[model samples]
Target: MNSAFSYNFPALRGVQGGKEYFVVMVPLRLIPKIFLFDEEEIPPEHRSQRILNKSRVPDITNYMLENSKEYVFSSLTASIDGQIEFQSFSDNPNFKDLGNLIVSLDSKFLINDGQHRRAAIEEALKISPELGEETISVVFYHDYGLSNSQQIFADLNRHAVNTTSSIGILYDHRDQLAMLTKEIIAETPLLERYTDKERVSLSKNSPKLFALNHIFNTNQKLLGKKKGEFISEQEKTFLKDFWFSLIGSMTEWKQVLDKELNPRELRANFIVGHGVFLEAIGVVGNYLFYNYPSDWNKYIEKLSTIDWNRSNRKDWMGRAYGQTGRINKTNQTITLTANLIKRKLTLPLTEQEEEMENLLKQGV
Candidate 1:
């Protein structure tokens, strides 16, 4: 069958875990009949062709006019070509004139993968609903499963930059944190001495560490297993905000550490004490904001006194290694510690800090 008229298969299909190549192929007549778009799936770009900022390529309209006549889709079985072939109707208005094209199929392809190609084709069909163009090159295998396909997906997606994934959201939120810090520093340029990385690091200290350490040390919770993976994304967001808020409250505390506390020595102390503190930060932080606000900073400062170079006693039956969990607990604990340090250094706490401390103590 011709490639152009072959797309009319059932929209959904399933594959098993075995290894086999099903001779699934497209028929010519079904291609033109396939509807590319519905109401909501609008095309994203005006032109299908990408603009080449550093190259001499003309704009989309001129590029299409000059090259459309020579364009050809490659066969699925042919040697792999690096060129990008599929383009939307809006990208090159002349894409419609190209007749049916052949494509090979792969066993484990998903709609999420073909979104762009599908979008372009759909837009073209919308503009000229009656116009007939059929067949697309597809190849398929049966029983060929996900592990093999994951590599293809990863390779195709290596440079794709997933802006929608949970990690992406975290990264973007970090940027927002940086921006907010910049705004704060504009008002008080004293913080300009700290790099973005430094500011982010300082913002993460909170007192939940003390509570979590007590729980873990008492064998009340286990953070090492593959448990709690479901809320991982939400936990991350919570952590980001918790850290940012703590860091934002640290202006006076930072000054005290700079003057009397020795940040380098204090940080070394934090890194060492984290093993016992990890559980507290993740488990207790959420509740303690209103539960133990009064002495949270004081507890952070106390915990920071634990010497990292000397302490190696295991916390969970020697079940875990490294200090990540402990270091991770520092956000809330350290925030509390910084506040205490400020008190000792004659820096009065802000009204927000005082109110927060009260709410935390009351578990409000």
Candidate 2:
């Protein structure tokens, strides 16, 4: 007789590709005991799925523990390498479809996907034992062998794609900066109508000058704020005033607002229509606000006099545009453009800015 332990779980039986599977909800406390990672190093001859990344386990654990109240996870997928049996209580055919799934404890259950979540749940339970009461959905498939499990892993991840940053910002309400960016974009004159709502970068033929994420990042730089940092009402007001004043000083922006110039014409003719210039302007604004809070508006007049045309190679070639005639997004280019704005405004550079200037002087 085979020595075995058995677990009976309420399950729904389903079939796909002529194979049987079970969908079951298991309590968090039982996860560690039922599913094994088999995380040891394997030689090439015995290798199955890619080796588990132990480094990522702690981060995922912390995410689960921190967001325990609001956290949501998709179903965990696993495969069992033993016989499984199902029994139903009622005689009705519909009732027969819903039954208790009994799996031999002697069966080897290996996670084909969601090993990170499995690790995280084990870690989280160590500190927050009460979480054991919560349940997670699991999909169980009978395992054929190593090659089948490896194929399952490959098939699971083959089409996975991450959401775009602009779309993330557009939908995120948890981030204060993203929230403020949307409001600010809605209020800014030319920006309100011309900003791309769901992309990080715009195509040459795109009608918008800025992407939602670009505007959010530029505002973050402008206020010297880190991502997800809280913004005070005073800071919000200051940001609004700063952007309004800066836009007011740009003759081209005013022309577009007044319908005197087409947006495409401005985009084709100037570097200011790109994200690099906008972010550089934000960096300059950040410096001026920190150093000259009471008189920063005075420098807005000087911005109008600086040539912003993209064809002005002497001013833009090495700063905003590279030798290949495309926008260069390197930090060096942004700093160089900010330095040009500082020079135009006659503002003294900070020690860090001075170092950047010296680096550029050395042709680095």
The candidate maximizing TM-score is 2
lDDT for model 1 comes to 0.34
Model 2, 1-364: lDDT tens per residue?
A: 1224687889988888898889999999999988887657666445445677889898778778878898888899999888788776677987776888888877888988888889889999999999999999999988899887877888888998877888999997767888888888888767888888888888877767778887887898889998667888878887888888888889988877788877778778888878888889889988877888898898976789888998899878878887888886767888888888888888887788889878767877
Which regions in candidate 2 have their CA more than 4 angstroms from the true location? 1-4, 38-67, 88-96
TM-score of 2: 0.86
lDDT tens digits, residue span 25-124, model 1: 3432333233122223334242112222322222322322333444223212111111112222333544432222223332123321333333333444
Error of 2 at 50 (Å): 5.0
- The true-versus-predicted C-alpha distance at residue 98 of model 1, in Å, is 6.2
Q: lDDT scores for all predictions?
A: 0.34, 0.83
